[model samples]
Target: MKYKTFQTIILISSIFLSIGGCVTSKPSAENNTNYTISPPVSNNKMVHVNGTKIVDGNGNHIKLKAVLLEGWLMWNGTLWGAGLTSETKITQRLEKMAGKEQTELFRTAIYDHFITEKDIEMIAEIGLNTVRVPFNHTILEDKNPLEDYSARGWKYLDNLMTWCERYNIYVVLDFHSLPGGQGAFVSDPEFINVWHSEEHQQRTVDIWKAIANRYKDRQIVAGYDLINEPDAPTGKNLVDLQKRIISEIRKVDKLHMIILEGGNFSSDFSMYDSPLDGNQVYGFHTYNFFTDETDVKNLEKLSELAKKQNVPLWNGEFGAHKLSWIEDQLELYENPKFPINGWTFWPWKRVSENSNRYRNLAKIIPGDDWKEVAKGISDLFGPSNKITPEFTKKAMDSFIEAVKAENIVYDTEVKDLLKKY
Candidate 1:
């Protein structure tokens, strides 16, 4: 079906339950409710080698450059769109918009109410293969009273496993927010101590044990992202703790990949010494366009370690501000000289935009982030893993051609988008 126009209307739909507290969701779907969507699928291939990391039946790597799943469908509190809420009405919209079941990978939000069995089916329809699940520690513990972090979440998670088997996609479980939030300085009081605390470290291990034992039999879960971005009270201790956590999960579920991010949330590729049972994947995040090229060079260094280890490395999450940068990244990936295992971009959107906040995350939706990076990057998926050297060169050349063809620095859509933001 085609949507000629969309309207936003306010409706009251109560999702309250005694087992898990609920509330009335804010504006979620469009007022124009003339659409058809399939529910989530439950026939995933969920393959694994010896019940652990991804591998071919013959012990080869499974190469797939999956797209990064963003919360374009709903907000859950991070930067950008998260500022719009202040713990009040945080998860309502998400819960309301979830469970389309056509999507493959849903990069979860700080509050992932968007999770529903029907949504898993929608993922299968979209031809997606996995969900790169992001979570805050509180999702496992519920530090806030009004929030939910109950063990009951596992009941639903098992339902997700059932879907993965029916639909076949790997799960990259990322710990986005730690007890003290993963960064250097978190204004949120819950993260007052940082990862250096013995309390926080212990809590992390315990949580993983619960996570691992819960789905040890399901091989679709590729690995556990040790911690999100640990810039806090920075030191070698965070690295050491990661090795220990790997040990913990290894003991519980030895058949899966264990991914660890770089130092600065991007990739600093520090040296750490904790070994897994030879089925681990080293991973990192990249937002270098927001940083200097020098930082990117540092992150690129991880490629060497990944090669030496014969382990695959993926940009767990990354997206650029412009279309040009998307192609540039693909070039880096195609560099047989500096091959990266796979890459996933930031998001995919469902909503048009958030009205109140001019600089909201949904900004990337109708206009900015998702649109600019989408086709540009997807186009770079050349026939063989080889990124045609001429590809990015051609992308740059296209802009130059546009400038000469129109003799204009500002395109119409760019101007309108900038004005809107």
Candidate 2:
């Protein structure tokens, strides 16, 4: 879609909003989700949210600030897994992410997350106001396939909305695993050799229509992510077909937000002369995994697009390939042009509470999942010199030795992790 700026101000004034604050420690839920620390605790970055200017889901205006909960394993597993499911586990994680303010979400895979009303209760207590539900085509229909909402999945979706409404968390129905997997899912047999086939395009539109009709009410459902990320193809026809999908989504869900992605995987955000509609918003996926550009360039692009679109530009996904960069990015070196409502890196931990080995098992929590702890986050995670056996034994000995002295206090948290490895 194509988006441009607007300059119409009848009146303006400064407003004092309560910025959120929280402890740097990983949160625990096995006992309670209460926090004991105070702010100016650092967040992932200097999250500067643009204000006064109005924005909206459809055509209306609203304020935006969000964090992506991408793939939180425990949140889904604890609620809808095959064996054990716990509300306490999921709620604890969400509550921690909510910090002290209302948080939005961009859930990567909401697959099999259909569970009981009790699950919804836990989510509400955590302070979430929105959820993006990604539906695999299989769940919508079983055919080789046209766009059709799966029989069993649609029923569960309705139930999900019912529970969401009760808890007040809005929903974004994302067509996550599209026929031709977007990027990571690109290995799927469906899209490998046929991204531009006429069959693929028709199927997508038909499926969207069915979905829009099923949930026409704009109140509970926030928006549709259109088709995840559109990439380049060896065949020109297929590439054109990919862009057409956005037009199709707009046709049906005109009132809701249409999330248009950039070229060849969501990573590259360059203008190809072919731009998104001005009415819709541009979606980008940024990561430290593979990049040659400087942070300055990245920030400049974000700002330029914001000025051009006059709409929100969201970082659908981003995380540090290594744990070391976490603290570095948190310093907020670059100035972003647009308002980034929220973002979700890839997946959350499968076991949110188990890592409480007295240590955090929830991925977002410190040491919960090594991958997440290391991503775009530092300080909280220890150095690489940590993965040793003797180091652990010595640290344990020192801790035991320190406890013997009643007059002293020893903080050996980092030491324990070295030994655990």
- What TM-score, computed on C-alpha atoms, does each candidate reach? 0.59, 0.53
Off by over 4 Å in 2: 1-123, 143-149, 191-194, 234-239, 271-275, 290-296, 320-337, 348-421
For every model shown, the clashing-pair count is 32, 29
For residues 92-139, write the lDDT of model 1, one tens digit per residue: 222222211211112232123334444455445444456666655655
- Using alpha carbons, what is the TM-score of model 2? 0.53
lDDT of each: 0.45, 0.40
Q: What is the lDDT of candidate 2?
A: 0.40
Top TM-score model? 1
Residues forming the 10-long window of minimal summed lDDT in candidate 2: 10-19
lDDT of 2 at 167: 78
